[model samples]
Target: MNDVESPIDLRNLKDALEWQETANVKRPWRKDFFDYYVDLIRPRSSDQCQILELGSGPGFLTQHLLSQLPNIEYTAFDFSAVMHQLAQEKLHASEKTRATYVVGSFKDAHWQNTLSQKYDFIIIHQALHELRHKRYAIEFHKTIRSLLKPNGCYLVCDHLCAPHAMQNDQLYMNKQEHLQALQQAAFKQIKIPLEIQGLCLFEMNVI
Candidate 1:
C-alpha cells in the first residue's frame, strides 16, 4: 500500500477516536505488548527516567506505562492534535501531571528539534510504518538514536511483512529488514524479545 492507502486519518477527531476504539477490538494482545515494555523498563522504575514515545497515538501505551512506572516522566509525541486530545481524555489527572504532550510529525527529519531532552528510553509501537515506507526506516532510527541518552534503549514494535506474514512491502518491513535498519543506525545489543500477533518488538541500545 502507498502513503495514500493509510487506513486511518488521525487528523480528524472523529476518525482518531473511532480508530482508537477499533484498534482496541482488533489487537487484544496490545496489552501483552505493553507488558513486555514494562518488563524491559522495570529496571529503571525507581528512577525518574525520562521517556519519549514517537507517534504516541491516543496514549494507550502512555497510560499503561505511567500507571506501571510512577517515577517515570513521559513525553507523548504525535503529529495529530486529535490524537493528543484523545490521549489527554483517557489519562488520569494524576498521570497527566507527569506527562508532557507534544505535537510533531516524524515524517520530517527536523521533528527531533521539538524535543530538547534526551531520554533513557525511546519507544514507538506499531507506528514507524506510518513513515509510509521501509526506505525511511533507517533515517528515522538514526534520529531516534540521537534523541537517546548514552546507553539508552529504543524499543520498537511494529507489524512485519514477510512471505507468510503481512505482505504490504511498501508499508511494513520483514524481520531482516528491521534488524538491518537498526544495525545501520548503529544501535547495539539488538534483540527481538517478543514477536506476537504479527508484530515484532525489537529491543536495542544506543551505541
Candidate 2:
C-alpha cells in the first residue's frame, strides 16, 4: 500500500487470493456495509433481470446480491484471471444461475468491442478507486453509462479521496470529483445517500 507510481498487480494468483482473504478477515465492516447497499438496490421482482458486476473479486459482491435476489441473471467481469477463477470456485451452481464470467478489462484497447449485451444494473463495488488515474476513472464512468439499458442503474461504492489529498497513482475521488465525472458521462438522478468509513455509495440512472 506504499505510494507507488503505478497500480498494484493483482493478476498474480497467490497475491490475489491472499488479498481477498485478508480483506475479509480484517475489514468485516466492509462486507456488512456493502451488503446493506446491495440490499437497498436489489431487483424487486422475480422477473428476469440482467446485472453486470465489474471487478468482482472472489464473487463476494455477487454472492451478497444473489442471496437477496435469487432469480436474476448475473454477469461478472474482471481483469485478473486468478480473481475470476477464485470467484468461479466460490459461486455455486443453482437453478437460478444465469451467470457469465469474463476475464477482461475495460482498460484494454478493444474491450468495449468485446461486450455486446447491455445490463439493467451495472455494479462497481470497492474497485473504482484502483483505476490508477482520474482520467481512467472518468472514462470508466462513461463506459458504464454506455453499457446500461435506457432505464438501467449504476451502483458504485468506493473510498473517497480526502479534500486536498496529494495526487498519486491510486485513484480516489471525492463527492464532487465523482459528481463531475458522472455528469460528464450523462448519468442522471445521482445520489450519494451514504458516506462512512471514508467510503461513499453512489447510485445513478443512465437515463
Candidate 3:
C-alpha cells in the first residue's frame, strides 16, 4: 500500500462516528487488541495510575480501559474535537469524571506542553502512524519517553510495513524500525508483547 491522505475527516462528527462503526466491523481483532491492553494493565489495577492515550480516537479503547481499571485516571488526547465529543458520549457520567479530554495534534512540536503532569502509562493504538510519515517516528518516540514518569511504561501498538504485507514505507515501518526508534529514544528496556496480522505492540520503560 502506498502513502495516502485519510479519506475521512475525523474532525467532522458524522465522519468520526462513521469511522468508528466501520473500524469496529472491519477489524474484529481490535477487541483482542483492547483485551490485551487490559491484561497488561490488570497488574496495576490496585493503584491509582495515570494513563495518557495518544490519538484516543472515538474512545473505544478508553471505554474498555476505564471500565476494566476503575482506579486509573485517564487523559484521552486527540487532535479532533469531534473525536473528543464522540469519546465523551461513549463514557458514563462516572467515567467522564475519571477521564479528561485534551485536543492537540502530536504532529506539532509543542503538543507535549499541553499536558501538565507526567503519566504512568502512555498508550497509542493504531494511531502512531497518524504522524503522516515514518521519518517522524524517532523524535515522537523521544517526546513520548519524556512524558513518562519514573518506572512508567509506554505501550504502543501500530501497523507495520513488512516484506510479506508491505505498507507505504513513508507511513509505516517494519518491526525492526519500530524497535530502533524506541531504543534511540533511550528506553532502557523494551519488549514486544504482541505482533499479529499487521500490528505490533511495544512495551517500553526507561528505568
Q: What's each prediction's clash count? A: 0, 0, 0
Candidate 1: regions farther than 4 A off: 1-4
True-structure RMSD for candidate 1: 1.5
Model 3 regions more than 4 Å off:
1-4, 163-166
Q: Rate the local accuracy (lDDT) of all candidates.
A: 0.89, 0.75, 0.88
Clashes of 2: 0
Model 2 has an lDDT value of 0.75
Q: Best candidate, TM-score-wise? A: 1
Report model 2's TM-score to 2 decimal places. 0.87
* Model 1 poorest 10 in a row by lDDT: 1-10
Q: Positional deviation of 154 in candidate 1, in angstroms? A: 0.3
Q: Which one is best on lDDT?
A: 1
Regarding lDDT, does 1 or 2 come out ahead? Answer: 1
Off by over 4 Å in 2: 1-7, 163-170
Tens-place lDDT per residue, model 2, 1-207, is 442244356888778877888876765667766666556655443677888888888778777777767767888889888887777676667723667888887667667666679988888888886565666777788778778888888988877777544334256777788888888887778998777666678899766
Residue-level lDDT of model 3, residues 1-207, one tens digit each, is 344587778898889888988987866888888898888778976878999999999999999999888899999999999898888888888999999999999988789999999998999999988988888888999898789999888998998898755568888889889988888888757898887777788998768
TM-score of 1: 0.95
The TM-score ranking, best first, is 1, 3, 2
